[model samples]
Target: MKFLEENLLDHLQRPEFAELHSVLINHKFSKGSYICQPGMGSNQVFIVVSGRVRVYLGCEEKEFNLGILTKGDIYSTHTGTFVQALTDAVVLMTDVKTFRQRMVGDPEVTKAMVRVLGNILKTSFTIIDGLAFKDVNSRLVALLSNEARRHGMSLEDGSVQIQIDLSVEQIARLVGSTRQTVSMLLSDLVRAGLIERPERGKFLIPNLSALESVGGVTLS
Candidate 1:
């Protein structure tokens, strides 16, 4: 059993989750895999150790992107979102039954609960703001700039390689927008000479400083 002995595990010392230290499952998944069906989550919490996963919500066989889980993150709240593997990944899984039982029986689980709840609330608020405040183009730009800012690797000729192979449609779902809007945003970026698409669905950032400035990350 892979143990969570890191800072997050300190929550187990709480009276709420002290007894939850046992009986959890660990597993791995390859790229293009489904971790759980949308709206069919069974109270399981997944801790991602490597790679990325996409969360989506659905109704009547239609699902949309909720968010992406990167390395060293956790996903427990269902909230109508089903977790899907975006890349080859590994995860630690524990269900809602163990969660409730552990919350009272294990101190660490209790503490972890508080942290996780705070994170969930924070993300919820951010999503609300993104939906209410930004236009579709701005939203897509912000999302791409943020993702590239974090995950991009600098190339030799001032270009940065971002590994995600997202088409405009995927990006539209990501920012809670439409494909036409995202296509316009991409076209704008392309015209500005800020992004280079050497291959279909792959975006290479040619100038980090300018992109960062537009991204509101002051180049310091």
Candidate 2:
């Protein structure tokens, strides 16, 4: 709680922002809580103060885990409920409509937010390009590469460990593949000593080079 304030309260110090932040509420979710569903009216922007969130979209009633959002990330009830905590989590919640209005009212906030919307646009393009041109394994590999670039931690082994652990089913959802396919790929990767599932549902990419088999990623 203190950390949340320390990190955010300063940046959100404007009188308008204070008013906006004040209206924001707090929510806690137990592990495995289904926080969002399709067709629900969403009105809040959520900032995780602790723990992590899974943001996703769905098709024909099947949900896709788009990405894992961690602390300091901001999300709103944009289309349906796009986010759900993966563990016991705390979030600072704000009314999205009101906040959007405020952004319209303040040029500073508006520009800052427009930048965000632009990024979403860019990601939508990425999704489109990926779906059309990439194979399931290639997509999964690229997604992991992106995740590692952002959230991976340096391990003593000179490889990086992505802290956001996920099951093959979750990975399957992200890559538009079935769990059976993900299981096969994962097993093959493990058997070849290219990756190690040192713990349940978690893979340690001890070296980035191992992911090269998935190929065509521009890692820099």
Candidate 3:
């Protein structure tokens, strides 16, 4: 049998997922709305059908972004992370118990769930590693480099433009620094000819290799 697809959107077209699909409840969230907050007793699994959601952890004083889920990504709400819409969004969701039951009956689906959980674990470890080993500037550079690889559009002039869709404050949260610090670092980058801001919520890397060099980490 074919292994289940990673994208939940693809699963919607598969006969094997029909039962689970039938039970999915559709919900919409406006930008900055919380889909799941800590200690909310959330027990649902959700798939992002449209727009972007931010998974993060923190108290009122500080926050750390765990990951951003765009269309086709899946997550379980019971993971205790705060899930908030970064943009106006729609999601299809079902109770965790129902999803577990389906996984128990379907080996392929179980495999897919395992892969999803594995990715989540890997991301956690990466964050931990960055916190323990990297300084603030290094962490920010790594974040930008990774985002470029994942979401950038190449230009004819050998530059890569990333629609990062995050304010400097949000980026500071992701890199565990103050917004003023991040802003200064960004200015330094611009002066060093590493990056440019052509518009709000976007970044242009004139030389991705040079930017990656400053972080001293290999891009996989």
Highest lDDT scorer: 3
Candidates' lDDT values, in order?
0.63, 0.65, 0.81
Worst 10 residues of 1 by lDDT: 1-10
Model 1 root mean square deviation, Cα atoms: 5.7
Q: What count of clashes does model 2 give? A: 0
The model with the greater TM-score, 1 or 3, is: 3
Q: Candidate 3, residues 1-220: lDDT per residue as tens digits? A: 0112456678566887787788888999998899999899979988889888888788666677666787777788888888898889999888998877765566655566677677667667777888899999899998888778765789999999887677999889888889999999999999999999989888999999999999875664
Model 2, TM vs. native: 0.80
Worst 10 residues of 2 by lDDT: 1-10
Q: What is the lDDT of residue 172 in candidate 3?
A: 91
Ranking by lDDT, best first?
A: 3, 2, 1
Q: Residue-wise lDDT of candidate 1 within 1-220, one digit each (tens)? A: 0112244534434454445546446789998887887456466776676777876565554344445666545567465566677778887678877666655644544565455556446545655676798666656656666556655677888788776656667667767767897788788878898887788757888886686556454311
